[model samples]
Structure formats: structure tokens, C-alpha cells
Target: MNRLNLFAPDVRENPYPFYATLRRESPVCQVDPNGMWVVTRYDDIVAALKNTQVFSSAGLRVASEPPHLQRHNPLSDSLILADPPRHSQLRNLIGRAFTATTVASLETRMRSTAARLADEMLQRRVVDFVPDFAHRAQANALVQLLGLDPSLQPNFQRWTTDILSVAAISPDDERRMQDVRRSIDEMEQYMNDLLASRRRQPGDDLVSGLLRSRVNDCALTDEDLMGFLFLLFVAGLETAVTLMTHMALILARLPGWMDRLRKELDLIPHFIEEVLRFEPPVHATMRLTLADTELSGVRLPAHAVVALLVGSALRDEAKFQDPDLFEPARRAQASLAFGHGAHACIGAFLARAQARVVLEELLSRCRRVELRAERLDWNVSLNTRCPLALPIEVIPA
Candidate 1:
């Protein structure tokens, strides 16, 4: 059987075509030598995500941690990989400090940071959207959210990129594993110091708020705080960076959409929604089968790793008509861009708000954004889809 390998160069570059083929030919097919399955159909993914008992979230750790690291990975202990009661406890306690209101409160800061970055990029006339604007703006937002010193902003992108790359690391790649380990160590030290500083002098940031939160008369342990901070620094920042970069890429590729959005600024939110569906930053999520289960009549053994292809599901013909076309106003069914069920992205609101602010800032200052005639280089990761760099030429308004 020709199993699909998601890490293959060609597939990593553009997995949608392969996803469509899998959904049509074999929706529940093995994608790895370890008997890991890939679920492509929208309905199948939805069912699996909702049935967390059978489809355990422990598979997220399996997909993220290299074999050498195993349970030692800090990210493995985060809220994203927890199940049931434990996940509930963490989410509820953390949710109080990460509400939509908290995100709303950051709008002024977000706008200022975005406007400054946009202005700097526009001054250059030609800029790489990923590093020049998206990375810097998202990093600044994260630092502000965490209430950390502004001096710490420079390493946020590198640390996040290294940490997130572990999701697709080859078990045999000793060099890459070492680099990831070094990054993890450094980030942990930084987080520990930051946490200590917060304890000494709490501020009005999310980290300080998280430090003060408690559940069942017990404050969050140092380990718990470390894991959560790691999650926020890596997943929160990386996802937002990917979202804004992709938005810029889309606008540069389709000048007409940019023109439309620039004129009808009110439609930017809808455009953001469609962008989440059309080209979601996260391409897939992982789950484990806790017990023997059948999906679409195919049997999956207990503990089998399953990859829910969120990218494919968004374009499934059964779910959305003309699934290939970009329609900003299509609100038939909610997209799984931020995921579904219990493990939906806790930072979705923050990410959406940040993207909107940055895009609006750029559009309001620029007449046109166009991509140069250069081949796009996508980041080599199994779970995320985004350009390594998006070089664009901007015409100032």
C-alpha cells in the first residue's frame, strides 16, 4: 500500500491536492510507518474531534515530541494535549484570564504596534511580509500580553520557530534535535526568570494574571505555569504569525481582493474568516484512539495516531459548495481553522483580532500590495502551512 507521508517535500509544499485525493480514494489511510492514520473527510474529522473519549488528544504529544524526548517535552504537558477533567480544569482556570474581553482590551496596543510596524515596512517599499512585519508585530504583541520587558522581543520569533519545528522532527536527526533542545533550555530559563519577576512584581499582563489565578484553592504549580507559557509563546505566537503572513500573501497574490478590502474595510473580518477556511495556518491536528473504534467503516486500533486534516476538511465538497473558490461571505458552517469541540484553540479570538488589526493598518496606508515574481518557499512542517518569507512590493496611498 502506498501510504501518504506528510513530511515529504512535495506534500509539505502543497498538501491540498493530496488531501483531496485521500478524501476521495481512502479517507482513513495510514500515513506513517508506525500505523498513524490520516482522516481527511470533514464529517469524519468532526466526529473524531467531538468523541474525545475514543479519540484521545494524547496523540498530540505523540506527533509533537521526538521519540528521544518522550514525556520530557514541556509542550507535551500543555492544555492542548490534556484530556477530559484535567483539560477542563486547566481551560476553565486559564480561560478567566484569556477572555475575549482581555483580547478586546489589547486592541489599542495591537493597533499601535501594528501601525508602527506597517509604517516601517511601507517605508522600505519592498519587504518580506513574514519576518519584516508579521513576525515583529506578533512578537511585540506577545511580549505586551505577557508583560515582559521589550528587550526580550528579539528572540521570540527564533525561539518560537525552533520549538514548533519539533512537531515534525525526524527521530534520527540528531543535529536538529540538539538545536531544538538548546532552544527549549534557553526558553525555559527565560520563562523561569520572567515568572519569578512577575511573582516579585505582578503587572497587568496575562502572565501576571495567570500567576494569580487558582482552582480548588490551589495555585498553579511552577511546572503548570511553565507548560502554559510554553504553549502561549509557541502556539499562540506562531499561529498568529502564520495567519498574518498568509493574509498578506493572499492580498499580494490577488490584488483585486486587496482593492475590495481596502475600499470596504468593514468586510475585513469576513475576509479573515474566509482566509481561515481557505488557507488555514494550521493544516492538521492529531488525536489518539483510546479504544478500538470504527470511522467511516474503517477500524482503528487503540493508541493509533490519527491526523485530522483540517486543511482538507475546509475544502470538502460535502461541507461547502464550490469549496475551491474564495468567498469571504460564506458562513454556512463554522470552519475548523481554530479546531472544534473541547480542544478548540484557546487563543482564536486573540489571533483573529491581531490579524485584523495588522491587515487594516497595512491597507489603510497602502494602495496596493503585490508579490514579486519569486517562487514561494513554504515552511517544512507537517502541521502548519505558511511561507518562510513573502516578499512583496507595496504602493503607498
Candidate 2:
């Protein structure tokens, strides 16, 4: 059989069919050329996520680093690259700022923001839902939640996109790395200033919260503070933006589902889950084998990179009945969308709340949302699954 070229344009357009074929033929197949094993079956992917010891996030980071960046190993100790105890410590320190109460309280504000954005879109008639609605709302919500200055919104957005772009392709490109380094330097300087100001006079924001957090009986160091800030700015904004954009595009395409959702507005939560399953914003997550491991009887050497095709796992027929079909009503079951085990998204609750508020407001306020363009363009990134543009006409209620 021919090798599966996931990067091929045809595969990117609609990869489910190929994924199904891979699951059937070789659930754990190695793309020898890339030195990466691709896991397609749902069960194996779940196992890999849960079994962090064997399939480590450290390997994932190294795999993600571009060939040029691999030499310097710039991200040697980032939270996402760490394993076990250290990962737990760092994650816990940052996770404190995103507690349930903290996120829940933001719902009212998020709802207000979503409604205001949707109302404005209605006034415009034709709207690019991605940038105007999804991107703006997600970015604004995150900025407010993190307590960053509103003036930094545009710069933050640009830096977030550039960082993710670097991750998606050409991790080692010197010019791009230089640009990223410059952005990081600026972000660090801004954050350090903010941290110092917060130290003098504390405020109700994430940076302040971090300043208050203690690890190993000591206040967070500058490296810890800056690293956490960097992680939050990129992951918090990019994932939420992509998820919102994908949700909008999917609803626009599947009018029947959209109509049903409009009628049953309370089902927005379930609908979001289905969207995560059907067209997840995070297509794949990379992992490395910390120790020699066997997956589905295939022997993998220690340090071997493995790319878990999360999109494929979500639609794995063996796990979910009629996986391809969008069924939000399925009995409340767990999915790997937010991931599983320890490294699961700390901001999952916040993301869901934000998405729910956006969809709820859109459905309640808009009478009809019709697609204005023939083809929707998707952002070409390996990790993030989102559309570049989703043009639609919003008819007010």
C-alpha cells in the first residue's frame, strides 16, 4: 500500500476518509519517511494520552521543533515539554488562576460580549465571522480574563498567530525564529513591567494571581512567570479562536443542525461537544516515547516521535457508533478533544463556557445566517484547526 501523505492538499481538504482507511488497514502505522508513527484508532490514541509514561509530551515538543530549532533546543524546559512531577507543579501553579469559580463568573461578561459582537455583525449584514466575530470575541474574552491591557490586543493576537505558525511549519527557520524571539522579548518586557507593577499594587488579573502563587515555598521566578504568560497568551487565545471559528463554519454549512440548535438553545453545550468531535480545533497532538514501548504490537524505540491523529480518533468507528455523523445527543460520554489524563486542557471549562455563550447569543439574536461565499478557507496549520474566513450574512431577529 502507498504511504499516507497527511500534508497533501487533498488529505487536508477532507482527511476523514483517509483516516478511516488507515484505522482499518494499520491502526498503528509508521510513516517511515518522517520517522513518526501515526496512531489512528480511538482506543490506542486514548491509551497513549492516558499512559503518559510511555508516550510523553517531551517527545512531542522535540518532534514539533523545526530541524533548525532542534540544534539549539530553545524550548528545553517549557511546561508542555516537561514530564511528571515538574509538569504537575508548573501546571498547578498556572491552573490556580483558572479555577471553576473564576471561569464561571466570567460567563455573564462573556455572554454580554458575545451578544454585543453578534448584534454588531447583524448591523453589518455581510461579515467575516472569523476575524470580526470569532477572533475578536475570543481574543477580547481572553484578554479580559487574563487582565491584560486592551491596547495590547492587536499585538498579542499577531504574536499568538506567529508563534502557532512557527509551530505548525518551519520550526527552525532562522528568520522566523528571530521574529518569534523578538516577540517573546517584547512580551517578557511587558509582562515583567506588569509583574513589577502588580507587586507594588496587586490587581484582579492572571499576572497578579501568578505573582501571588507560590511554588516550592517561593514566589514564581521570572522564568516561570514569563513562560506561563507565554503559554497562556498563545494557547488561551489560539485554541479558543480556532474552536469558535470552526464552530461558526460548521453551523453555517450544516443548516439543519443550525436550525435545530436555534430551536433548542439549551442544547448549546451538547452542540459544542459534537463540534469538538466532528471538527475539532486541535487536529493532532505529538508525543514521544520516553521508554521503549509497544503500541498495538508495534515496537517503538525510546525517543521515537508519535503523532496522535486526534481528528481520526474522534471519528474512529470502532469507538463511537456512526462516528462521522454529528450526534450531539449521544449519551454523555468522554472524548479526547480536550485530551485526557494529566495534561488535559486546564482551560477546558473556560473554552466551553465562552463557546456556549457565543453560540447561545448568536442563535438567540440572529434570525438567519446564510453563507455568502461558495468556499470557506481553512487555516493551513498542522496543530490548529480553524478557518481563515467564514463569510456570512447575519439577519437580525
Which parts of model 1 are misplaced by more than 4 Å?
32-35, 59-67, 332-334
User: TM-score of the candidate numbered 2?
Assistant: 0.92
- lDDT tens digits by residue: candidate 1, 1-397: 5887777777877778888898889998898646578898999999998998998886567656767654367777788888988888888888877788888988999999988987887889898888888888888888778876789778787788778878667778878878888888888888899999988999888988988887778677787788889998899888898899888888887778878987787788899998898888788888888899998889999888788889999989898899888888785444599889898889999999998998888888988888985687777665788888888988897
lDDT of 2 at 59: 60
Q: Which segments of candidate 2 are over 4 A away from where they belong?
A: 32-35, 60-77, 167-173, 215-219, 332-334
| TM-score of every prediction relative to native | 0.94, 0.92
lDDT of 1 at 102: 82
Q: Assess each prediction's global lDDT (C-alpha) against the native.
A: 0.84, 0.76
Model 2 per-residue lDDT tens digits across residues 1-397: 8788776667777889999998888888776436468898888988898898888886666543566543322334457676787788888777766587887877888888898999899889899987888878877887777777888877877777655655544544678777766665677677778778888998787678878887668665677676667776777787788789878777767777767888777677888988888887678888888888877887878887788888999998877899988788984344577777887877778778888889888888876678888765566665666667888988777
**What's the distance in Å from true for residue 192, model 1?**
1.3
